[model samples]
Target: MTMEDKREPKRRNPAKTQARILDAAFELFSSQGYARTGMREVAERADVATSLVVRYFGTKAALFEQALVRAIYERGFFVRSKPNFGERMAALVVGDEEARIPAMMVLAIADLESREIAQKITRDVVLKSLADWLGPPDAQNRALHMLTLMNGFTIQTRHLRTGDVPPESVRWLARSLQAIVDEENAPVN
Candidate 1:
């Protein structure tokens, strides 16, 4: 076959390329934190041109925000019944590696700009949405407490390498979380 006949056109799918870049950005940002991760590195990981990563995400802060949202909220942790909320959240804190990534990313990010983005998203979107889902009777305050507990548990379990949390511990945590979710125990204000 002639050289012209043998040549094949390059394939370009913006959606797939964007997704690959986002996944790479998520992995790197979660593992290395914001200041350490770079566009070139992300492009290398995603197997795309660095310019392409820039084109798709515009800025590192924007990329980080999107990656955080995709990693955290898209998991649908907030979509649950009140009765099983504690158990489900406890399980996530105990074993879900995916659930831990966003928390890790938030904790790891040292850059002020990136930290602000994380804080804004966590507060405006995640916290607000979770509080709304929880319903009233001090829902906002309870949601804050619940998130505090979960984030701490995730970081502690992940860093401590304390393998296999005891069933009793998990149960206690679940009950504690349930107390926050249930309006019966809310302090008289």
Candidate 2:
């Protein structure tokens, strides 16, 4: 066959390509971090041309921000369903190591590198959404407490390597959080 006949067919769907790029970008940005990761690397990971990445995202910083946001929501940080929600959350926090560590690291970078207003706005919106999911009677407070616990767990275990805290400890933490939920739902005399 001639060289012209050997060329591969082009991708027909822009949306699918964009989604793939975003997913690849999120994974790389999370694992390698924003500062360390490059546009070429992101494009390479996405299996697209570097020009396509720039055409879609404009710049590496913009790509990082968008990727980080997608990663946050994709993790379902505020979309917990009831009836064993706590257990489900525990499974995500403990089981999803690939997503967890990178999220924490990228969040740290966002805090340090991005604007304060962006972080504050994201924090407020996420807390409100989570609180709403959690229900009333100091839902905001409960949500914040739960977030604090999760983020701290991420920082301590993944970053600090704080003593080999076993899987059972994580289970206990989930149970303790569930106790809070149960107490809140209990009827008063």
Candidate 3:
């Protein structure tokens, strides 16, 4: 009997494989954007067959949406209290490079459908949740303002390659965001 014949083939776990694929997809999409990221590249990064990626995700858009949603939820941005929301957001924008993925995705994707998906996720999931958490007295508008501030800051930091944001700058940004949350400095509407 040949020794090679006795070896057992590796078992496949669908759930783990899907998770790995999603993680790989998120990494690629975030770094390369949807237009530049390919399914084969995702499969390669996940260390799986390209056919498996297509079978699981169906299309690049579907995969992009799923990966983006998963990344957003994993961030847990909405779980924090409103009292220090500004400070938390400012810290994320200034210090957490990983936290900038959503904004990066939004700016980087050029394809119409993929761009729409990114925008929709940003508005529907992120904006809606933040507005809901803020609650009343122009919560929607305030949340929009907060998102704009954070997104703009994220882009600026990335483009300018600003390292180690000054403590005073962070504090200033925090105060500006906190003012929006507090609604004390909001203009009459």
Q: What is residue 166's positional error in candidate 3, in angstroms?
A: 3.9
What's the C-alpha lDDT at position 37 in model 1? Answer: 88
Report residue 78 deviation for candidate 1 (angstroms).
Answer: 0.7
Q: Per-residue lDDT tens digits of candidate 2, residues 107-156?
A: 54554563442365357656677777788777878877877677676666
Each model's backbone clash number: 0, 0, 0
* Candidate 3 lDDT over residue span 1-189, tens digit each: 688899899899998999999999988877667788899999999999999999999999899889888888888787777688888888877765665565556555578888888888878888998888777788888889988877767666655655766788778889988888888445658
Candidate 1 lDDT for residue 42? 96
* Best of the two (2, 3) by lDDT: 3
- RMSD to truth, every model: 2.7, 3.3, 2.8
lDDT, residue 13, candidate 3: 98
Mind giving the per-residue lDDT tens digits that candidate 1 earns over 1-189?
A: 899988999889999888899899988887778888899999999999999999999999899888888776667777877786788778877775665555545555578888898788878988898899877887788888888887777666665656777788778879989888887455668
In model 1, which regions exceed 4 Å deviation?
2-8, 160-164, 184-189
lDDT comparison, 1 vs 2, better candidate: 1
Ten consecutive residues with minimal summed lDDT in candidate 2? 98-107
Residue pairs clashing, model 3: none
Whole-model lDDT, model 3: 0.81
Question: How accurate locally is residue 177 in candidate 2, as Cα lDDT from 0 to 100?
Answer: 67
